[model samples]
Target: MKYFIITGTSRGLGEAMAFKLISPEHQLICISRTKNNDLIAASSHLDYYEFDLQNVNQIEALMEQVFQKINLTNADGVYLINNAAIISPFSRIEQANSQDLMDNLHVNLLAPIVLTSSFIRLTQHLPLEKRILNISSASAKQLLPGMSAYSAAKAGLDAFSSCVGLEQGVESAAVKIVSVYPGMVDTSLQEQARNTSNEALTTPDIFKMVKDRGMLASPAATADKLISFLLGHSFHQGAVVEDLFL
Candidate 1:
């Protein structure tokens, strides 16, 4: 049996991933701002925690409470999946407010870093095979005219994860860090990005494009692939794992 911690379990990819990881034999701890009734009604091994990732200072306390409840430190291995993110509706850089950009940074970049750091510290006594999978975006690689802040933050996160992987190797720890770029999916964020008033947005008619090209995959499909990769493949083979067109 394996223990897993996943964030943003209320909806979208996070929700799908949580359900994918649930089974009679494994344990799943899901965190989000609101409780997901589906996950709550699932197996007893599934647990849920309601916390706002925007409140960065409470993350450590929240983790402590979760570990205390699950007794996770005694486990042979743990998987920390940082899958939560926020995208600003503002399309243009000038149109984006300072606070909105900062909020994006908090949720997208800072929160993941802090959580991964905490995971490393908390699992210091655990055996090898502990993994930290960071959900990233292709936007980090290509510049989208409208999504400046979101793209920048994800890029920072990718860089941070790469550095963490190197540091772990140097420390002779078995903990592996992987930054994954899951291709665009049919999610609310896509809807919002498509509707945002960004004149220079390169992803013109985002919803229509996704529909026309049949490019958007279901969240469940993406979740399944991610779980398969995490369990069956070695993420340490590469610092950044690209899951495009999967």
Candidate 2:
């Protein structure tokens, strides 16, 4: 059986991914802010943990509870997707609230690192292939106004992934680390962006284009590609594993 531990599975791209991977052969553990009855009713293989990623103090204990559901003895593979994020307080660097910035860091940057470490420590002896996917953004590469907090957090995630990959290479561990930049999907994040009161921010205009021109990608389609990559079902074997973005 394959194991998948995904964060932010209650809605949007994360929700898309959770439903995409459900199967008799796949055991899913979702971390979210609320319980998903539909997901639980979908299959016995589905399980979830409802907790805020912003609560940095409880992550360790939470992960312990998560691992209890996994059947490591019969596990064929493992995957971790750090998909939870916040789009609030989308303001310029100076105008951003201190509390908002801190919250963003906790959810977007720190949670993934904590979860990745937990996965590595727990699965070291499992003798199964493991993959880590960090959901990143185009904002990480460009200077977009009003996205200072989001941009900084995602850029940090990408750099962190690279460093982890390098360290693993020296020891030759059987693990894959990637940061995926899922192109603008038709998600609620857009709604949040559009509602921001920051007048200096240009995100609203971009979001408007996405909505009016029908340029947004479907989360379900993106989820399929991401899961395919994790399962090593890709057609392009020569592609750099570090560059996969759904």
Q: What is the RMSD of candidate 2?
A: 2.6
lDDT by residue (tens digit), candidate 1, 211-237: 678888889998988887777655672
Residue lDDT tens for model 2, 27-102? 9999999888888888799888899999987888888888887878898888888999997668877887899999
User: Which pairs, if any, clash in model 1?
Assistant: none
The segments of candidate 2 whose C-alpha lies over 4 angstroms from its true place after superposition are 170-173, 233-246
Give residue 107's error in model 2 in angstroms.
0.2
Off-target runs (Cα >4 Å) in candidate 1 are: 72-74, 170-172, 199-204, 244-246
Instruction: Tell me the whole-model lDDT of each prediction, alpha carbons only.
Output: 0.81, 0.81
Model 2, C-alpha of 55: deviation from truth (Å): 1.1
